[model samples]
Each structure stands twice: as C-alpha cells, then as structure tokens.
Target: MMIHAMSASALSQMDQPAFVAALDGIFEHSPWVAGRAWPQRPFASREALLDSLVDTLRSAPRSDQLALIRAHPELAGKRAMHGALSAASIREQLGAGLLACMPEEFALIRDFNTAYKAKFGFPFVIAMSGLWRGDIIAAMARRLAHEPEVEFAEALAQIARIAALRLAERVAD
Candidate 1:
C-alpha cells in the first residue's frame, strides 16, 4: 500500500495491526530499522518523533547494535547478500569504489577494519550519507585510534543519526 499523504492524527487512529503494517511497508527496505518498535502513542511533532527514534536506537542492546553492524558489509568490496538495505546504503557501498582510486586509502580501510574489530569485536560503523570515499576512509582511520569504549559510544551515536534520518522519512508529514 502507498502512503501518499497522512496527517499525524489520522495515522494515530489506526489500529495496532494497521499501524504496524503501515510502518512495516514504509520501512521494509530497511529491516534493521523496521524491527524496532514505535512509541506507544503518537509523537506531537516531527522533531519529537525523531528524538524518540534516536533514543531507541542509541539505547538498543549491544546484541542488536552488533547485529545491525554485522548486517553491513565492507564498504568497498562485494555488495551484501542481504536484500533489506535501503537504496541509499547500496549507493554508498558502491561509491566506496572511489577508495580503489587511491591505494593508500584502500589499504587504510582494510587495516582500520582489522584493528577496529580487534579492539571492539565489531566492524567499524559510520553513516556513509553525505560523505565521500576519502572522507569515510579518513574517518575510519581516525576512529581506529579511539579507545574501545569511546568507539562503541561513537558508533552507537552514528547509528542513531542514521536511524533518525530513516524514521523522519517514514514518518507522516
């Protein structure tokens, strides 16, 4: 079903099943985000709604966060076998090809991934939107130097930002 336009009040009046179904449909392309539960009551405004979504994402259990991180494939190599990522994510992965143009950057990403996983037991996480390949590699390299606790917190924060953006788009205007 397509949701062209929906007011907040109209959306709130929907039954539980219908509301979940609508959210599922809108967010199906990004199941990691879809798997999260919505607030019990309607949010008063877009900002309030986004804030809640961000909070949920930030406070998600470590297992959930690790699952989300593992769901993402290495940025510059093969595409993920999973079918649920958004088009934006796919494009970002593809765009990482630019890293290949610079051998040092490519090597840096590889090394950083290794060190990051060794330090934190998970892949490095970053929101690839609005970032170029060089910028991402640079950020990865920098983040590689962070303490495990600091990196974990930073990764969670970036994930929240990404979730907030996705939630904002799915929310009825």
Candidate 2:
C-alpha cells in the first residue's frame, strides 16, 4: 500500500519541477500558513493551482492575514530576518535603501505602524514590490488616512496578491 501510494505520487510529479519547487519553497518559508501536509501532491496545471491557492488565501480570515503579515519584519530595521523572505520582498520592504539614507522616514514608519495598528487592530500591509523608501512612506501616510473598514479590506486584498505571487513562483508552467 505504501509502495502504491509512493508510485502514484512519483507518477504525478513527472515533468513538474517548477510547480513542485514553488510549493516547496513556500512551505519551507511558511509551513503553518495553511496547515497542510508537506510535499503536497504535484499540481495538474500551474494556472489551476495558482487560482486555487489565491482563492484559499483570499478566504483566510483577517487574523490569519495579519499573522502572515506580522511574520514579515519592518522594511528596514535590525529586526529583519533576511533569509525568510524573497529578495524582492526584502528590497521592497526596506524601501530601496531609503531607510538607510533617511532616519526620519524610519521614524515615520514606526509612528504609522503604531497609529495604523491602534486604528485597525492590525499591522500595515503592503506588497512592497518595486517600491522605494519615499514611496513606502508616502503610502503609509495615505493609508493612515483610511477608515478601519476600508483599510482592513485593502490589507486582506494585498495579502492575497502577495500570496498568489509567491505561489505562482512555485507552480509548473
């Protein structure tokens, strides 16, 4: 029975390294994200799997989304755990090295985080892709102006996008 299952799994994985790699990479970084078994079965098609993963992520509650966001460190700070996130994610979070250049923006991020959390009960969430420090600070200011209900929905949507991109990287083409 074990041999049969193993053989079935091996057959399912044929010519699907990219898909397997994507899922493995995500699980390696965040094993508890969805609380599923490791070495997940190979996806039949990349698009279908990505769609399902996005749906799964979108369905997650706000608390779950916040947990995932909190797993990420501040964009530029000593507390950042470098290897846990994608390089692009790290760069975006750090704000294209602006945090190194401007101390005030760092202060702003700290203040915004406090205010945003006090107002919305969750950390500020952003995709952080292709964003510079000034851009991030600007976004923080703008988002700070949002009502809790608006911000909560936006945060979840952004989280879903981030998860989808991460999952897509793992799926077979």
What is the C-alpha local distance difference test score of each model? 0.60, 0.57
Per-residue lDDT value at 60 in model 1: 72
- TM-score for every candidate vs. truth? 0.71, 0.66
Residue 105 in model 1: lDDT: 65
57-171: candidate 1 lDDT, tens digit per residue: 5667877766766655565533433444456566556565543446676666777777778887877777766778778878888888898889878877776665555545556
Model number with the top lDDT: 1
**Top candidate by TM-score:** 1
For model 1, the stretches where C-alpha displacement exceeds 4 angstroms are 1-11, 14-36, 80-86, 94-105
Residue-level lDDT tens digits of model 2 in 1-173:
01112232332455445333435434224434433322344545545554555555556675765666565555554454344555545645555664464667677777877787788776777776566767777887899899877887787677666665555443334
Model 1: pairs clashing at backbone N, Cα or C within 3 Å: none
- Whole-model lDDT for model 1 versus the true structure? 0.60
